[model samples]
Target: MPIGILTTDTGKLVEIRETITLNSDAFSNSFHEDLQFHFNNERIPERVVHAKGGGAFGYFEVTHDVSKFTKADVLNGVGKKTEVFVRFSSATEQLGGNDAARDIKGLSVKFYTKEGNWDLLCLSTPVFFFKDPIHFPSFFHAMKRNPKTNLIDFSMRWDFVTKQPESLNGFLYLLSDYGIPNGYRKMDAFAIHTFEINNKHGDKYFVRFNFRTEQGEEALTSAEARAQDPDYYNKDLYNAIEKKNYPIWKLEMDVMTLNDIKRVDYDPFDVTRLWKKGTYTTVPIGCLVLNKNPDNFFRTVELSAGNPGNLVPGIPGPLDNLFRSRRMMYRQTQVHRLKVNHNRIRINEPLYWKVYNRDGRPPVRENMKDAPNYYPNSYNGPVPYIDPARPKERFTIYERNAVDLEPAAYFYNHYLCDEGQRQRLVNNTAQSLVPVSPYLQQRALRLLSLTDPQLGIRVAECLEEALETPTPAPHAIKIPRHPYEGNKHYVHL
Candidate 1:
């Protein structure tokens, strides 16, 4: 094969010496047009959260018929396959951060169905920090580095957790062994917010989706995670795909009918709480298999966008407040980061789409080729297809102002029943809490005590053993008033 000539971005062949100027006087088009232009625009804005991630290309196969629950074509026919792109990320880590950090993992899947793209955004934990979206900013701020010190402050995290009892469930999950997975292949993903699905008969059902790892659950201890490579999970996933050892997850759902919803004692729409174990039926949906890795990590994985609001026909948008807030937040963030025409990016583009949205940025391919951009026009333009099976009425949610800890209590007393697991949880919690102030630590212990006295005692013991100096006496420990204590309707459990 003949060697190709080095050229500028505009395709002008360049001599070797033209790449560099002899003195500062000479102008080199090859250096300016090729090297400088590419270097100046190589990076985009980093995500505020979930910045460290790896993605892959694969397909989702429907293993079972779910037409009765959701008329979504991707889940309707058995053996049907839809091309998919999945991005696995750490929740609070910034760009170039350690992949093995102890944090909530983000598992976002984008299904390229014939109808359009469907984005399912999920986290590693079954429950979230809080139900109300109002607390989102504060919660993230607590998890992030402190503004003053520009360092991760455990005191801030413990303070937030101790004040907002609703965060206990997710806080426990984070401090437990589940916090750090061995790798992305061994982790499970949960769509924490409950979604509404309708069928061809207009039968509505409340559902929570889970992607259980087929490789079985495996996690890394704190020491092991700290010792591992910075890009441990990303490398593990990529190497596994390259070696044809594909990672697979079984898609399942805990489904609840309208009657079941009314019969339940707890609020089903709360993202902070989990649906009771025996209250809902768990049904197998399908399997997600990732067999191919991205050829270009930046173009394919980094550029990919997944938003929860990208729903197909059968599966309507979730009505929960958290989901409602996320629908706007994700789109707005993507627009700010990737621009208005982000959907046109090759990795995020759907199989088929027609809309009145026209040019705003570059890569607006063809701009729909001068088609009728305005709706209600005399020309033959695309029209909306109304589905008769779609539900017309919105699902109603009764509001409550209570901080329920039964979920966390149940998790500790029942789920962490094993002595070894409980001990590990205590040790993990104590290790993180050791750096926090004594007042914040005492408040955290009080919060844990509200969940389970034995768990709190064990963690307190662990903390004392880890600390060199003696901790403040129980009588001397003065906890400040909780932020929500003044609320008349706020019930702390």
Candidate 2:
């Protein structure tokens, strides 16, 4: 049998050239055109956040029934297994950045169910830096490298966190030993935001999703993490899956009713605050086991885009400000990076479906054929799902305090039971703030002091030791022109 001949993008075969020369004529060949196309279009824009990542194919088995909470078919019965692709990433870095850096780790999962794709986009930490979505850009910008010097600016970060005050909870976690996980498998994951679930009877409940690592939580110290390979976490996950030692995470839910929201001291919808375990019953619904590694990392892992908005029926999200912003941003970013027809990509696409979307750049599937693309046509068109019988869901969120430093202070003083861990947190935070302007340093210290007076004084002492001088008095410093400006260098003894 003859091998298949190569063709151009338009499927035109090349004829034998009578006279071939290594000149301008060589560029006319479709082969050359194909090569140029491939070369120019090899890379897509990396994710705005969670850029450095590793992922695997997995199965999430519903071990326990939660039919009363959600009408989703995947969780309706025990022993049911849904195919999933899970991606673990560092939240604040580019593609080539270190995976084990002291940053929040993104844990996103795409479940390919018969109904549609359901994504549970989560983070390693339970709470986030800010509760409002409007501050999203500013927060990221602060965490990112400085524009002028192209270096990580600790002062910019400290300025933003100190000013916001609400970010203390997350700042505390990010500075603790838990900030750097031993590997993806050793880390627990949280939805970080509340979501709503509906039952067959149309009953609704707000819940926070938690995925506890079966491997047990383990983290590396700053020195220990820096000593290992930057890609240590990625290698660990890949190697473990290759050896059939699959990593497992148990799916747990903290259920809260409408009445429970009023009972809580903090805003239930605030991503910056966590709901205590005692406030709601902990129920285990399923377990995820990653048993297969991606054959091509770039294709299967890098190209996969998971969004919280890609939810199936029965699993709907709340009206949380951050959640709404994320839903919009996720769609926009994916479209910008992967093109309008991004969902058609193999890794991102569902098993089978016919949607109204059509005729975009490099569409992979059928162009909807002769079906009526427009909705509300008498000639037969898909109709939106509506259930009037469902009870109306309503709730209220009052002005919760963001400036309260109690959480961070409490975590530092009581949560870190080990004196060594508490000392490490203080040292890490102080070292990070060393390069910042004294004004910003004092501002951050003031916020920390609100958390605990002793904690603040200790951090101040550590900052003084690192700077080899006293922290500048807050009222004496002059403001800079640029809003986010910082000191270049700090004097050392």
Candidate 3:
């Protein structure tokens, strides 16, 4: 039989040209060596976060038949086989860290549906920290180790938290038993956003997704979490699969009508709060079974890509600012981490990728060989996914009219819904700062005051009772060198 090799010269499929070679020739070794050298340099880039993750091959079968809710083809067909790559991650920091750390878990899945790579992004908790987009940089800085100290400072972390008490709700979940789960198998996943479901008729409904584990949620205590090895969660997951105790999660979605949104007391679009489940029932979607594991870790796990941007036909997502940010950021990261061919990577590749994007990093299938690289080409390149039956679904975008951009906006600020978010931040932050120098405590007090006056007073009074001596350089330390800045400008300092 002749060797079957790809022929890219033709617009149509063709076999490789046959060549004759002497098997005994020593020059053949030289040819093989040169080819191996090029092959060795073929590895791709890695993702910054969600870097360490595990995935499996599975199908997202729609049991609810939400076609009336969305034009998304994936959710329309019952028992449809949409090739999916689901990533489970640690939300607090990088993927290199242990699975059982005190952080929110991330659940991102790429569904290779007929519409496109429909990405479903969510978190372990329903709410998030901070609402104003401005705090993102500051919050991320506090989460990381101090540049000079190279250590995770509890003081630094709490310092930012106490200052932005709005993050209290998310922190509540972070500090709870749920924060450090045993493994991916036992953690719950939440979409954490109010999205829209658009049908062929263009009718829209507010929706949220929840993935509850069939195995039940079990978390480790703080002491036990710290005592065990960092890979405890990873090991637990791998072992469970190895033992054939295959784990599954029931996919549930809470949906509300436009009428419900208008009637609700608070903003459902808030990332920090969950729509009351009783107010809106979760219709069963389908089961997510993690049966197969990857053979190669880094290629499949580390460099894999996921974003909330990838949406399918019937499942239309909400139009939230954070959700939009995730979509663009994730795409940009994919370009850097996995190269322009990030989407083409085995793990990120869609089962039936019918689109205009072609030619990047690695060229599989003649790199759409000889086809018109650009759209409107005469050659048979991929075409975009559009319903032959109807128009696309769109949601209303609010650019801030009445609502204050705090509290309900993020995980930390929970005053809008859950009872304990703000108070926890106040107490936890006050206690942490209570032991610090008086000068630092006062600065901290002022920051908390910015959130709410009562919060600041409570924190300051708590510090006063714990009364550490004022540092000798109190005035000098508080005052900065050079010209005074804007709002924080206090020449008095």
- The model with the greatest lDDT is 1
- What digit string (tens of lDDT, one per residue) describes model 1 on residues 1-493? 8589877777877777776776654543455566767898999999999999999888899998888899989998889989899999999998888888989999999999988999999999999999888998999999989999989899999899988889989989998888999999999999998899999988999899999999999988898999999999999999999999999999998999999999988999888888888899998989999999998999987898899999998899688788888989999999998999999999999999888889898679888887799997888678888799988887777667699999998888787758877888999999899998899899999989888898889999999999976767667767999988887595689
- Tens digit of lDDT per residue, candidate 3, span 1-493? 8566533233233322222234555344444444467689766554445555566656676766777667777777778756677777775455567766777778877777765787787788777775566676677678766778876665666677667665655765665555677778888888887777767776767788888889987777666777987777668777887787877888877888778877876778877655654567567777777766778877666767777777765455667777777777778877776678777777777766555666656735447656676877777876655565343434566744343324423433432244444444445455556545666666666655664676668667766665555546545546576564554634763
Off by over 4 Å in 3: 1-46, 132-134, 378-394, 399-493
Backbone clashes for every candidate come to 0, 0, 19
Residue 376 deviation, candidate 2, in Å? Answer: 0.8
Worst 10 residues of 3 by lDDT: 11-20
Report the error of model 1 at residue 35, Å. 1.2
lDDT of 1: 0.90
User: Model 2 — TM-score against the truth?
Assistant: 0.88
Q: What is the lDDT of candidate 2?
A: 0.85
Model 3, position 412, has a per-residue lDDT of 39
Error of 3 at 53 (Å): 2.8
Q: How close is candidate 1 to the true structure, as a TM-score?
A: 0.93
Highest TM-score among the candidates is held by which one? 1
**What's model 3's TM-score?**
0.74
